[model samples]
Target: MAEAAELSDQPLFSCRNCQNPLALRSNLLSKNFWGKTGPAYLFSHAMNIIVGQKEDRQLITGLYTIADIYCCNCGEVLGWKYLRSYDVRHKNREGKFIIERAKISKEY
Candidate 1:
């Protein structure tokens, strides 16, 4: 699927190694962003296939802690899931699934 130049409509993603369905095209977190850790190129409001654990280091956003996410099936490092604190803005964006495009199987 990655060989194609354009992405498919309503694309459903999978883990590149195990083919486990992850997120959809609509789940993209919008604009790609770079952080101190690296880059979170995509984000989804929800992703059932990903599992994460809290990390000690937090990001630039106060009350916005990050967790490392991995594939439930293959145990491959996916991206991250943000666990927001009491801050209103941070709470609003909680449960977002930030991902790395290259790590996920592309649909084209």
Candidate 2:
């Protein structure tokens, strides 16, 4: 399938429950670099989102640890947040979000 086209200058991504803007199309991590696997879309980036310690899972990626990112409005499992707790060779993907692009809609 073709990627969703941007409707505005900065496409506002929103939650399904409350229609709250979560991220933007410009913030897409796939276009720039390699990202983690999401529900559907690959190379997603969780740049601007809320992160919490509680219920956060520590997923090991080489040496970096990743946590779950929830929706600020609905507390939904939006994606994963990178935690740079380990000492990896390179600190490129230190902190990022591989959000589920399918869960979010491109709001005009």
Candidate 3:
């Protein structure tokens, strides 16, 4: 396992356009889709069907399969992918999230 100190020391992902450090936004995690019941009901209902109804339903929030890092200078996408975290719940927690690996595209 990696150490917390090692993770924190890593640099934050930045945007390619502006060269600014990308902000971690939850909405950028995945593609938004409308559900049958309604736009708001789609995600929650989909989760239920996939994971099944259970006590930990509240805890088991849908997955964030992507991360958006932008540039500080020009506002460009630096990278994108499913972030690897030590704790799923406390992903943004200090000493938890780390850029262990990343894929930088030409756009970035």
Candidate 4:
């Protein structure tokens, strides 16, 4: 009963393609982010995601070693995870995730 209550209180973000739960609204850190397409969100945690190979990419912020994240259920390319950041200024985002706004839907 308590678990159900907790789940109900926490809104979820799911994949737009297959409705796979990706992250919780509580884990959302920032919405002022950019992805390959457009707006993205920074999340402190994410679930049901497959982290792809680590590679160095020069983003607008700086060079970062990131891995492409995919939906585990439908294998849709959702976003990427920051594996390593070359810049100290971006160190806080090292273990975080950037999920594209267009790829996910918010569930109440």
Candidate 5:
């Protein structure tokens, strides 16, 4: 795993709207059993959420709680999962709780 310091001096990828740095927060499921026998070690970024569109986009009002995994500088919108309401419920399935959304200032 790469350390945050390693990416500190490096240019950051940011959101087009807020211009905040994108942070990498691995999902628990993906953190488990990623490497088997076939493929070496596949660290999937699918778990990450995106915020802005490109470079001049903003964070939509309705679209909140985005799962981000990118840098802050240079406006690089990374992986994100937009949610409508705080109450995300699904029948017969375990509900996911998104604690809160934070603006990333550095890389990791």
Candidate 6:
């Protein structure tokens, strides 16, 4: 259908500064997340991003080893990726990406 075709043509998220494609809407997992700037979204997969060094940090949920993610095109700090989680309850987030809502724009 027309809607399906349109959806396939556009990215779900993009770098606000450079408009580089970041993640597809299909990869979106959850919107109930927090980032350094403010609200964030969790994605099962992300593209056109650079994962920084892994560092352990104590977050509201628990201690997690995360890497700051940057937009490869513009080098903007978008959010962080969970490289490791100390708590079993948060293990599901180990490989997920948390993109800050303020750093990315919805393409649709």
- RMSD of candidates 1 onward, in order: 5.5, 6.9, 14.9, 1.8, 12.4, 3.7
Q: State model 6's lDDT.
A: 0.91
In terms of lDDT, the best-performing candidate is 4
Q: lDDT by residue for model 1 over 1-108, one digit each (tens)?
A: 672324345686778788767776676766466544566555655454556667545556665667878788888887777766556766756777776766667664
Ranking by TM-score: 4, 6, 1, 2, 5, 3
Better of 2 and 5 by lDDT: 2
Question: Each model's TM-score?
Answer: 0.66, 0.61, 0.21, 0.93, 0.22, 0.90
Higher-scoring candidate on TM-score, 3 or 5: 5
lDDT of 6 by residue, 1-108 (tens): 885576568668889899988899999999999998799999999999999999999998999999999999999999999999999999999899999999888887
**Across residues 6-54, which tens digit of lDDT does each residue of candidate 5 receive?**
5465554334445453333442223222111221111222223434442
Q: What local distance difference test score does each model get?
A: 0.66, 0.58, 0.27, 0.94, 0.32, 0.91
Question: How much does candidate 2 score in TM-score?
Answer: 0.61
- The candidate with the higher lDDT, 3 or 6, is 6
The model with the greater TM-score, 3 or 4, is: 4
lDDT of 5 at 83: 31
lDDT of 1 at 77: 83
Worst 10 residues of 4 by lDDT: 1-10
Q: For candidate 2, lDDT tens digit of each residue in 8-89?
A: 4567677766676777766666633233454533234543357866343435445556666777777877766666645556
What's the candidate order when arranged by decreasing lDDT? 4, 6, 1, 2, 5, 3
Candidate 1 wrongly placed segments (more than 4 Å): 1-9, 35-38, 46-50, 61-63, 85-90
Better of 2 and 4 by TM-score: 4
Model 1: ten consecutive residues of lowest lDDT: 1-10
- lDDT per residue (tens digit) for residues 54-90 in model 3: 1211113444434433333453333222233345664
